[model samples]
Target: MAQITLDAPASHAPVRLGRLLTIILAGQFMAILDVSVVNVAAPTIRTDLHASGAGLQLVIAGYTIAYAVLLITGARLGDRLGHRAAFQAGLTVFTAASLACGLAGGTGMLIGFRFVQGVGAALMVPQVMSLIQRNFTGAARARALSVYGAVLAGGSVVGQVVGGLLVSADLFGTGWRPVFLVNVPIGVVLLVAGARTLPGDRGEQDRGLDLPGLVSLAAATLLFVVPLVLGHEEDWPLWGWLMLGGSVVVFALFVVAQRRASAPLIPGRVAGAPGMRAGLVTIFLCMGTFGGFLFSVALHLQGGLGYSPLRAGLFFIPGAGGFALASLNWRRAPARWHRPMIPAALVVAGLGYLGLEVFESGGVGFEVAMGLAGLGLGAAFSPLLAVALTHVAVADAADASGLLVMTNQLGQVVGVATFGTLFLSVAPPTGHALTVTCVALAVTAAVGACCATPLLRRRG
Candidate 1:
């Protein structure tokens, strides 16, 4: 177990604590909210810009790609630069990027700005968890984590709703632009509040950036991700397959390089930790299903059911509300509950997927399917996170946290690329494709549940 450092006695007044926490939470919510917020707006963007399917995918994937690639580097930068400086810088960049996204005149510009926005988000997000870990201890830390978990779930739900509202409102006749523009006000407030309130942690400033490792990792990811993302669009050409093969080689090279590097980007020991390994694998599977489900469902509601974006957004509210309630209560639940809860949640989510499959033929049962999925997801989300981080040492906490989130993003990218390709390949978008995808998600959930069995048994 990593030794825990007691926080330096807080000098701030009691009233200031609330403001500090709020500022931190607002920053956290803003970064996370942007992840899902773009989904509902995709159709509007497509219409507004006359984008092809490939163009639309680029808009979403570009952000995720940038976000994933930069996250670890961002965290390390925080450790080097002082969390407060990194946080403020990230917030400023994120806000400016949001404005650029809003004013973007075409698909290419918007996608580029989204990539920049993601870099800002990557820079900002790690600080939230790091700050919480640094400032709080024991029960306080647990409580703070619970709150953060709720914020994560809540932000995702709110993103969908907010995107819907913006698209539906078409404020200032800006259509999809408001989805990006809405962040400006929120970002400004967060930046100002963070500047005033967030404490600086500048203790570890001597560590050097791992540029070599960063290059290798980025190259490896591009090799793999480019193929997965663009393969279908380009009809699985020879170069795509060649790139996929090269990704394996590049990944091997990356592993070797990291092992040899004087200052490794990702410490070999941290990545090799059994607990971290299991946790990341679980996150990958869980989020893979999650990313695909959200993308497909949004499309289904809009394309298949002909629901307005607002109506589609409304459908996700129950899930979000349920997630918030469950996350808030998560810490209070028994330790034994932790072992079974994640698997049970996966089972529940699987059942929801099954429900979706059964109800795909009709419009009337859509809400019921969504509700079941939400309840299951809400119950499982926090528990999975708690379980994943259960064995992490405090010193490695930041690294472990970065890995967990990176895995989640990677899962989403792969899920969207692979499953989306499957869905699109069926052509003419049919209920059958939805049914198959739902069943596949159910199967994925079952696999997650099976993996959790050992965890539950060991805990028992």
Candidate 2:
């Protein structure tokens, strides 16, 4: 394969185009995989690293916070420096951080490394979407987007299953370390493949970094995420409340800073766009419920039902299949279906949850109900993503992409907090609490459906 140099045009021949897509998609798979893989490994990590409940929560929250904070900046940088350069640089950072995570000695070390890994992921993730817009056009671009959505959904399911297998296998007695170590071989292959196949940077050299906006945004995220993770563990301490309050203030300040900054981290016009605004809100609700459902389901299967991690992961396979099927046919689906699909998918997902609440006895019926939830999720996510990004301008594509990613992450954080809090507040045994959590999650999904209906109508 010929190396694609910095000066090459965006066009690709049929043969090379296949390689380009492979390189881009591989990077994307790694990014999405990181988000959910850790859930399966959390128990092992807690046992091995002697992580407290709080420490375990940080392991997840830290990564998400760093990833969310840096995403917009990463997108902006990509736009300024060229998507390919940003993508490669991001991949390199992510690979190194994964190794750091695998080698870490304690909970603190793992949390720190995870944060760094998220920074790299943030840098790489936005580039994936930007690359699609840059490299493909018209129907081809739409096709690429569909593939991207499928990969996103598929990667999440694969993460849980793969993490379970790796943990259970305990290859070389490394236990959960395999979850992080596994990325190295994959990353090496991606790097070599990307070097040979990815398109080069297309932007001019003079674009500068937005340091001030980056700092404020990071501060704002820490204020928001740190409090959420700590609040429940500490029984909502004063500092937690203070941090939550401060987050609002810092976010307000960040908004003011962005308005004044010449090179804002998030372009104001893009943020203000009606489609983007609706998209971000929709993503927040959808991802929040999705994230909570996954977390709750994992706990239900493992903690409540006493299933092994591998078995728990297997339960999600049907749902993953359903999502893949829906995504494959999404293009052929009518545009009118788009408006109603959001609510419909939510209703299905909610009913799946309701079924769990009503019929669950830790049996085959429970697993079937869970699969239905996945089917609903699959039906909802791709179409929703398409609707969200539909009206974004090409020039602001990277920024818009970053914002969408941020909302998704934020949704996960909020979901975990809201649902986790509800489950914990009951102070019941693990099994009962999980059941109640599923019910609460079902109700939340129903609310999401209601909110999404208006957006669908607006889009229609």
Candidate 3:
């Protein structure tokens, strides 16, 4: 098969970075929203379909399982097929799956459809970063990356808002179904726009897909993600522990397979990029705190404070807003400041958590605390990503993208497993549990700040 390098866009067609980013980002928003929106609709779904507890759990976990496991494979496919083709195909599958989920008459169907939806997300999401890395340069790259990070962070809040609104509005008395159906029109529009505007590579994949590496990696991801995601719910059963232990072996096998492959899924240059390890650690800690904070906070709000689901969801809007504002504009700071910004901003995030602990009573103080956290996080993430990718050749954009995204998903799972468990283990007095959890999250942020020394620090 014929192929061109990442630098070679198909000469037959024009590449519009602006148009392409818009379409791809829209798809990303939809995919991330689905991850959390379903939580708001689960009770209604149970009532509608008389789902057993296990079925409801499956409906949620199935998508996560498929998505997390297949992500690296999806990224590799994007590299081979061209990001545009992979993204479009993923969007098609997701849109169709969303419709099927909305129309499902039973829990089993919804569960199956949700997994298909995740498969679509896995195929599509890695391309967002790959495309940005390929098309944008200098300040433009920074800005595009900022917007990508905002969309990455903000999608969960928006999902909660949209899901709550749809359920509460019960549009046409469809209840929870509209949450799924709402994606249909948006997806259709993106599909059409993307087809017309997104750039494409002009050739076929040159090498065979890395089947051994793919299987090993998939197994490794499942072993880590499944145990993290379900272990808490399962009361940390023996099998989950075994899976966790087995993951080390699978990961070792994957690393060996990747090294032996003629065309590896993750190239060594991309993996060895300067600041790569620190970037991943920062991303992990950032996402973990956010995940654990989101989960435990929501529970505390609803059960301890007697807030409605919508209210609890809406409370997060301030954090999302602050994050977007910070991410979209923070690159204007001086070069000298960039090295120190990550740790400084993360310290701010730590302070925000502490402020929340103090102002747990609510009102402007609480909102302010949330916004402060977002501000710090948003300021840090984009720069961290930029610094991380500084040495990664554009040719290996897909590999960098896949690595970052996989690390992010892993961080969230681990965060939920640990912090969420702490929040749940305390009997009654959820306020106390929330306080304890917040303190722990704050401490984690402080550690992240210490750990997140950008490679630029040495240069500066």
Candidate 4:
């Protein structure tokens, strides 16, 4: 806490924050990048492996499903194992999995390794927020989190470009292999740095794993997410709807179990913090919109307009730039802007989504609109993240971090499923489907902003 004070040595504080953030965010970016990077390499993988359509889909969905399932448990593991150890162990697993994926000989092997990669990501990524929470506060925390937000947006953009470049280059004639191989060295560097620099936060005093709470929540999440991830691909089969419906029942049981537990995984006090729940809701909506936009726009560009996957991905750069610009600088705005920032900025994002209808796809107008959406979306994330944690006690930061991230990942899953399904099922024409999906995305943003407005206004 003393490090956050104005009186702290400027040089020391920045040096500490810089070293920690670089190590933590590099790992974070690596995990996030893998989520998108593989999509670009999918075609190449299919050709090389002689994969079926479903096998190819698994190569992509497997990582996400595994990642979603284990996140909260991983965060709790950090508390038990210590943040640094969890991070190192997780990174090591992730890096090894990356290597395995690169060398995978069959479609099944690649899919299996990809899931293992997700397991690694789940283990490592949660520590990032806990580390930030443990080490920084006040304006320092804000700046650190802003960079976190920037990474969140930037990773997806870079993944597309990097994936495109690596696949196109066929570096060493390895084709899509470099995308996975690329993480090997970066992971090694981060692992070494993290072992030295990451906070060795003391483990919580003898708290049991809270197995009942952990198992219940993990089950609820898996039941919920599995349906969303695979359902649309299967054309929303009856089993998908059944699983989706059943997740609610399981989640309700989880809540009941948590109430009875002495040491709940997510504490009541933390979850009940002012603006905490509301902030999570806002985050869900905003991120869901982001995920939806990316899926629909990329699909439109590549499938509908006949652009190469590389070109489709390239167009996302302007949007990524917009996101980085707004996320990095929004704190400089007047204090009053802080409270209204989340929803208000989200409205700007919605306007950008709507702008797609007014402008041609991949044109200057489209790029500008995409950038505007990115900027607005970028500005919105960090503030809500702060608000969610703003009232949380320091002791619960790790738990809070996991819940926040789990919610965010789930939102993206829902967004992509909902938007992608809408795009496919509603409008038969590619152009019409994009316009309709954009309109829907714009509407979701507005609703999210409206819901977020009151909590932020009163809280700020």
The most accurate candidate by lDDT is 4
Instruction: Please write out the lDDT profile of model 1 over residues 180-233, one tens digit for every residue.
Output: 888899888787877787886774667767788777777777777777877777
lDDT (Cα, tens digit) per residue for candidate 3, span 246-289: 99999998888888899777778777777888888888998888
What's the ranking of the predictions by lDDT, best on top?
4, 3, 2, 1
Question: Which pairs of residues collide in candidate 2?
Answer: none
Q: List candidate 3 segments past 4 Å from native.
A: 1-15, 458-460
lDDT of 2 by residue, 1-460 (tens): 1222122235567557667766888888888888889988988999999999988988977777788778878888888888888898999999999999999999999999999999999899998887776666655665666667677777878999999889989998998998998889888888897888788877645655678877888788878887776688778989988888998998899899888888777787878765566656766877787777777767667776788888888887776776666665666778668668877887888888777766555677777777777777667776776676666677878878788877777888888788877767766466677678878878877877877765655632
C-alpha lDDT of residue 287 in model 1: 73
TM-score for each prediction?
0.89, 0.90, 0.94, 0.96
For candidate 1, the TM-score is 0.89
Candidates 2 and 4 compared by lDDT, better number? 4
Instruction: Kindly give the stretch of ten consecutive residues in candidate 4 with the minimal lDDT sum.
Output: 1-10
RMSD of 2: 3.7
Q: What is the C-alpha RMSD of each candidate to the true structure, in Å?
A: 4.1, 3.7, 4.1, 2.7
Candidate 2 CA-lDDT value: 0.78
Candidate 1 deviant stretches above 4 angstroms:
1-18, 50-53, 272-274, 361-365, 427-429, 457-460
